[model samples]
Target: MTKSQIGLRERKKAATREALSWAALRLAVERGLENVRVEDIAAAAGVSPRTYNNYFSSKAEAIVSRHCDRIRLVGEALRERPPAEPLWEALTRATLAPFDGAAEQPDPRWTAAVRLLLREPALQAELARAGADAEAGLAAAVAARTGADPGGLHPRLVAAGVLAALRAASDVWLRADPPVPLQPLLAEALRQLAAGLPEPSSS
Candidate 1:
């Protein structure tokens, strides 16, 4: 096949994967994560169980798999930031782009589904694994931005710090009664990170 044809084929495959994942997440949110099976997700996506397994090993994976794409978007955004921009500013802006764009927002039911994942010990582990993958992607991006070795501790540490702040911000927003804007919470998180979290006074 020609290169353009190959690109189109890959795009189609990606679209399928996204469809399956979105369906899985939606179902999990509507019901409960544990209550939703792989077969259920496959049916929801109009695919067979074999196809679902080809894309994801388990239901938990299918639910949170799109996190890698989010990381890549943030990484690309950071890469495109002006050279004079501060690291925190670039990182925060990059992190916020995906949430602000034309992409479909998660249903309100999905928000509750995420809370269920957080509460479920097994699903929580899967979520953590997905998070680790995102962090690795972010680390590579940070290494490229600062010219650090990809495997170096600095890149990993910086990536962890940034993601931790992002997670904390999300948690705070999620727990709020009316749900506050994520950007301001994220900004404060970055600010706290940049300022090195306040230290207790010495005795």
Candidate 2:
């Protein structure tokens, strides 16, 4: 196949994947996760059930795939940071940059849907699968930046810790009563992580 053809094919696949994920999230949020099925999501996305199955194992996986995509984008951003930048500085900037994009503006409905997904056991399992993949990608990026072996302990530990901080921030943001902006919360989380989680002392 020609280069243009390959590019077109990849773009088409990405569009399909995005459509399926959006449909899954909307349906699951509108009708409850237990009420959503593969066929329903495929129909909503204008794809067949077989095509949906090709992209995701279940409706829960489809719904959570969007978060997984964000995680992948963070890893890519981290990889592109200046090589001479301090590890934590690069990580903080890279991790929050994606959320800062104009296309990533806050959506209360989407945030609520994510909160609902977090409360679902089946969806949480799918999220764990996605998290594992993100962690592996992050470890590689850490290794590239710090010259540590990707398979060794240092890179893996740093990647895991950074992800944990981000996760904690996300949970706090989602649960906030008045709805806090995610980017600033995530920034503070990374900052605290970089600062070694120091305690406040009376001065």
Q: In terms of TM-score, which candidate is strongest? A: 2
Per-residue accuracy of model 1 over 36-99 as CA lDDT, tens digit each? 8888899988899998888888877777667556655777788888878877788888887766
On residues 32-126, what C-alpha lDDT tens digit does candidate 2 reach at each position?
88888888999999999999989987777888787778877778999999888898999998888767742334466766776876799988898
Candidate-wise lDDT, in order: 0.77, 0.85
- RMSD (Cα, Å) for all candidates, in order, is 3.8, 2.4
What would the TM-score be for candidate 2 when compared with the true structure?
A: 0.88
Q: Please state the error at residue 200 of candidate 1 in Å.
A: 13
- What is the alpha-carbon lDDT of model 2 when measured against the actual structure? 0.85
Find the 10 residues in a row with the least total lDDT in model 1: 101-110
